[model samples]
Target: MGLDRAASIADLRLKAKRRIPRFAFDLVDGGAEAEVNLRRNEEAFEEVLLTPRYMVDVSRIDTGTEVFGESFAAPFGMAPIGMLNAFWPDADLTLARLCKRQNVPYVASSAASTTLEALAEAADGNGWFQLYVSSDDTVTEGLIARAEAAGYEVMMVTADVPAAGKRDRDIRNQLSVPFRFTPEVVLQCALNPRWALTSLKHGTPNVANYADLLQSATSYADVQKTLITPSFDWESLRRLRDRWKGKLLVKGILHPQDALRCAEMGCDGVVVSNHGGRQVAFGPPTIEALPAIAEALGGRIPILLDSGVRRGADFVRAKARGADFVLAGRALAYGVGAGGRAGAERAMEILLLELQRALGQLGVPRFADVTRSALSDMPASQD
Candidate 1:
């Protein structure tokens, strides 16, 4: 089906599944262990009820929002996704350009398949960099310097992944960086000719940010070792906060205390996320976790929600529950995976339309007005 015919992100997801190899599809689609947290992320959003006020002037609903002192065309932006090109050829650059054209933020991942400089160029002023905080201090400091030189106004330091989640699908697929091209993988690629041909042309996606580090690094294991600082702690966060001159946000916050600590330690914002349910299988969904953090922070700083935001109403649900802004990785992932830029733009267009319609239904004029007050039931704070 064409981009216009794709009604929902689910449609695009199915389209992507059909077009890409199963192994590649599962790499993005699957989550850790039994993926209970993943399922809960979406299901929690379902349980959130909204109270709509009628007889109000809802004619002009403004989805435009200001976040971290920057104006955006919408209330949400594209979340960072690593190895995006592995799922769709050149998807990293595609989504970056998509955000640029759409006037939304694109958080460039430290692990993104394309170079940060290239994505920064594509995103222009709309780019924010998400850091993984490598074990090497120089590498970590160098990345921050690069982002600053590249004109990224914000750097989001990820806090959730101390160790990589063991995704069962990847294990089953025997997935390796630069792709091992085992018999099964080769056959799977052969079955999905479009993906196979496109991937062959794109070359195997690698850790582009670690080009110099990986020059001597022998294997994918060696490459993986160069990523993510496992000993990262509150001291590490404090030190990081001290160094970055621009706005800084701590991602992967679930508990209110952790959220409060970030705020106390001077983080510009906190992204209430479960790492898209990829970090832990039993963690609370981001939606379920937002109210407490909101109550704790009491709007001291901006709050951004990441993970499981598939539709425009989901963005509304997040806003009503308590997110100042929100971000989603898989919408653009599904978009690019389905049909590159057209598919991504279609997905974004669908969300923008959905958000406008949802605001109209809620009798709210602007996304900024969407708060816990919009919740049908003013329930007690959630832990």
Candidate 2:
């Protein structure tokens, strides 16, 4: 379907799958292991039924909200996506500009194909940085310092990926670095001329932020080994917290104890994510994991939800289930994959439109007003 006909994030996904090569699409679409948690992420959200409070003056609806002294046009924002240009040439800068225009937070991934500095400038003051926490302390420190120099206010450290999740699709596709041109991949590219031609014009995306270190690496495997921080622990977190000197957040938090400890230790917030079901196959869906984490924090920290949030109602469900705010990576990636900038714009339009309708339908004035009281099928916890 054309962008004009694409009405939902799912439609965007379908268009993307048809537009890009299998290996390329699967890189964004596939999750870890059997992808059980991926399916669970959306299914769990679907099971949450929001009940309307009816008879209230629902003539007006405003979805605008704020986080960390920043006002967003909507309650949600874009999460970091690594190698974003692989989906569409210049997608990283495109999305950063999109976030600026949309008045939402734009997080630049450490592994992004575009430099953090460029993304920061494109995203303007709404830019945030997400760290993968390299095995080398010097590299980590340099990245931290560069982000600060670029004027990033918020820095998020990923906690779930001590080692990379074994994504099965990458294995089957022989998805390797330096753009492996298997006959099948070549054929897929041939079929999708728009993606192929654009990719040719832009060149293959790489780990732009880590160019210095990556240039010295022999293979992608070596690159992965050098980057993965298996030794990162609470001590490492404390050290990072001491060094960043910005609004710090820990992403990939599921356990309540971990969330509470992060709050106590002075983290500005925590992104309650399963890495969009990409990191852990066995972890609980983020929606189901939210309440206990919320109760654990007890309003001590901001809880941002990520994973399988496609529709606008999904945003409301996440907030009602206890997320202070929500973020989506694949949803936006699907947009770029479908058609570049216009596709990404459509994704945001679909989400914002759906979000406003959801709030109005639920009779909630704003995102913060959506409490667990909106929940129906899953009864309130009788604490």
Per model, state how many residue pairs clash: 0, 0
lDDT of each: 0.88, 0.88
lDDT of 2 by residue, 126-225 (tens): 8999998888888888898899999998999999888888899888998875567889999989999999999999987888998877876766677776
Best by TM-score: 2
Lowest lDDT block of 10, candidate 2: 374-383
Assess candidate 1 and give its TM-score to the true structure. 0.96
lDDT of 1 by residue, 1-383 (tens): 88799999999999999999888899899998889998899888888888787898998888889999999999888898888888999998988898989899999999888889999999988999999988888989899999899999899999998888878888888887545778888898899998989888988887788877877876566765678878999999999899998899999999999999999999999999998988889899999999899999988999999888888899889988778999988877998898988888888888898889989988887888887778878754520
Q: In model 1, what are the clashing residue pairs, if there are any? A: none
RMSD, candidate 2, Å: 1.7
How many times do residue backbones clash in model 2? 0
What TM-score would each prediction reach against the true structure? 0.96, 0.97
